[model samples]
Target chain A: MTVQLDFLKNVLYFSGLDLAEIESIDKLVFEKSAERGEMVLLEGESATDLYFVASGAVKVFKTSAEGKEQILSIVRPGESFNDVSIFDGGPNPASARAMGPVLLYGIKKNDIEAILRNHPRVVLNVINVLASRVRHLVSLVEDLSFKHVIGRVAKILFEQVGGGQMGRGPRLTQQEMAAMAGTAREVVGRSLKALEEEGAIKVDRNRIVITDKEALKRVMEVSS
Target chain B: MAEMPGIDREKCDGCGLCVIVCHCGALTMVDKSINIIETVECDWCTDCEAVCATGAISCPFEISIE
Candidate 1:
């Protein structure tokens, strides 16, 4: 088994495939690299390839007409992005950019179609990934419509703290948090301060802790 | 609570991403744990706290926005 196969084995869309199918994909995939903050795919560009992150992170985001940016997801290594365009034979729904220096493996759309024709498992996996993304979007819409900035901010922080675990969770940048909460960074900063005032969280130089999980959850429960 | 962000030695999980982002020389990882030197005052940029997932580093100051 080649290293590429091993990496493909772990991707969300490529998971559950046997070694043989993975070997074939290795032939069709091409390697690409991008510097930090470089554009990987642009919105409205006709779909040409399905990209998988081989290393580093990709930010999938949409821009408002007024030029405000809302990030949808951070596509990490062993994850795929821009599959919507590849699947539907349409332009990209969102633009993607490298969060840092990144390595990517992209399979052209025609080859992806060929693989789908050969492997039914790949088709099912794609369906599952799309379904999961839709469910996440639905939740985001509900939060945007019904939840205030404080609630959204508290919810992200509480979820990231890993519920009393000693030290487990990824580094989430404030900008990323703002994007996830569908608000501006200033709003999130204010929300954090408010959460601390409520005794739900503490942010000292020596320690940033979720002091009261219950309080945090209650704040999350509050609607806009 | 020090004026700038401080590291909770007990709560810190030793993910050095915070240390990497800290522009000030205030934070260091000593043996897989965050060590905040008392000598250097943090600039209070809050970048360290922004990257922390474990809530190990806190970057809060009193702000009145009434």
Candidate 2:
């Protein structure tokens, strides 16, 4: 019980709450575990609860009629999702899938609403986070629309490296890269090949190594 | 044909930013106006809509999937 309260207090949305408030929230939340590739929430489903990642990761994405997927964002531990649906009283805007074995704390909408009503400051925090999300979505739109495949791939690489720097990032598959870039897998493959030819990035069996970050940035800057 | 995004010509300043942002090459600029050249490739991600500073482009027929 104390452990759960501690976890609740660490969540950004609940961080403003005092220990007593955190304890109260802990009572209203329940833990849910999902294996990798499990669908935690489906797009268009009624938003009944808000979820906070307790452990592992979740991928929020949209799929087309032809099964093409565009990843919106990846929610890491301590992050929350479905807040928009909960507040707007609308269905989920996107689907959430477990990227790995995941643990989440599900807070019923009614319970959360009650807490928010009592603590208006928490609402401010929520707004701040939502605003950042808007910025990210706008940047993603810019990347997809204005940037070429190689540029998009380079941008993703730089982002994964925590900005344009030579570093090892997560081991992402070609399909994952395609989804992040909002393009097809073949396009991502071709772009990576081009980058490799330019001596900008080194591709291994599972991961990519940034050989020259400046070159990658130059690739992104060259207008198509 | 896939549902394509609508551009409000009246509001559009013909900045051509939307043309540059479309990854699928669905948008083109003809006579300083944005046009949807290929609707099939358009995933309707609304990248053009998001970047439209004048709020000119919108996806009227596009469902709110995300």
Candidate 3:
């Protein structure tokens, strides 16, 4: 198989597999593509395969009865998704939609199960992955419960841009931040302005650069 | 569609989308679940229900004004 070795070596899910083992997976995997705004997996539908983003982004979200899209997360390249439902053999709790033209490697659920059975180490790695996700979700819940909107926005910015000072901050628009935070765009704008006034961050066009990581971290730590 | 009166404790992921969408603060997350703090003054416009992808909120069978 002519699969990209770098992608295989770098992807967390496939990192453990050597060339031969990866080749076996390659045989079972096939490439798929989707246009922007297209649904990859619909909510309440059973997942048939596990997908890894080879390129582009996908948004995992659920729509309310009133039709508002609640974005769970925006998945980027090298991330694996659909595993939650695939492993449980239950219908997808949420849906995934392509954020743009997306390239993915899809492996049948049965093939992955077989791989895990034979490659016991892979199962352990999967457990670690799931545990890490659970930890992240728990943290998200805690943040939503106690942290104010500004803190949540700052924390999100920190996660996306890291601790380094950037000449130009994140390129995300306020609307995007609002969607991610499950809040309104105006609220995100107000929070960003407040952060800028404190010299904690600076807005450059669409981006917001963090002036001080330690201060922002402090803000995230402050309750209520 | 009639507005969902409130979330059943058994459901609701507490994702905060309902609170986010409600122009009114009728919906709030409590103990990782949604609670309708007030049902009156609820526009009954189904705005919160529109955003609940998990189907956690069910519409009130009958609307009663307080």
Candidate 4:
């Protein structure tokens, strides 16, 4: 199958590559699709290629002793999965499942290494991505320790409200918000009630409408 | 859907095992005791509870702020 070099060029890692280099890199990359509920990777399996989401979403999670799966991260389009394990020479640390119909680009580590050697810009881009991940992890650690559960839940809703079009929506279900916050579903339910009573936000089904962004930010400002 | 295991500051002996066993890097050694960091990645797996020997960990069924 022909690789979509032009499309690949738009991804940050490939933006600096020339057409010929893009074609060469694309030759080593393959496209794959997964339906919702399909496992993308098995935990403890050898890590081989990194999967970049081109469309749809995936959930990274691991099974607990009680056989309950704990979601570790959500991978959206323009992001890649299995990065940390690949860098550590370790097996896949977690399993991934397609949150919905997903399309991904699979690139082997060797190919990525070769590209990095030739085009150092790609390495910088990857480093930026990994650094951002580390920062996010660090922030989460801080939130768990210092912030009150209510503040954490409110902050979660506020953060999910991005700029324009996407921000104004119905309130999300307590379960989904709790899933994203890594807390109990009821914790979210209670927090939403508190916020609603305080006129912080309005909850409607699974959508959370940010009625007062400033007030919500104040609610999240409490230290643990 | 459980409260994340809580760390008893007085009981924890500053051992970092919880930090070591946590797959999502949710547990951190803060001031010599184990503390859970709220990352979107945390799944409340209770690994810290399983690893803690002092019985300092507990996952409450609820966290009501009101």
Model-by-model lDDT, in order?
A: 0.73, 0.74, 0.68, 0.68
Q: Distance from true position, residue A164, model 1, in Å?
A: 31
Candidate 3 per-residue C-alpha lDDT over B1-27 given as tens digits, one digit per residue, 9 for 90 to 100: 323355655567666666654555677
lDDT of 4: 0.68
DockQ for model 1 equals 0.09
Ranked by TM-score from best down, the candidates are 1, 2, 3, 4
List candidate 4 segments past 4 Å from native: A1-3, A145-224, B1-66
Clashes of each: 7, 3, 11, 11
Residue by residue across B1-66, what tens digits does model 2's lDDT show?
A: 565676689999886666655667788889998887745777654556544657687653200100
How would you encode candidate 1's per-residue C-alpha lDDT over A170-201 as one tens digit per residue?
A: 54545567788886554566566778889988
How far off is residue A149 in model 1, in Å? 3.0
| Candidate 3, A92-205: lDDT as tens digits | 988998765678888899999998987777888788878887886676555445548888887777766544543323444454676777765445555676677767776643
Q: Is candidate 1 or candidate 2 better by DockQ?
A: 1
* Clash pairs detected, candidate 1: A204-B6, A205-B5, A205-B6, A205-B7, A206-B6, A206-B7, A206-B8
Candidate 1 TM-score to native: 0.62
User: Each model's DockQ?
Assistant: 0.09, 0.01, 0.01, 0.02
Report the Cα lDDT for candidate 3.
0.68
| Candidate 2 CAPRI grade | incorrect
Per-residue C-alpha lDDT of model 4 across residues B1-66, encoded as one tens digit per residue: 323556678888875656754667777787887777767565654445544556566443221111
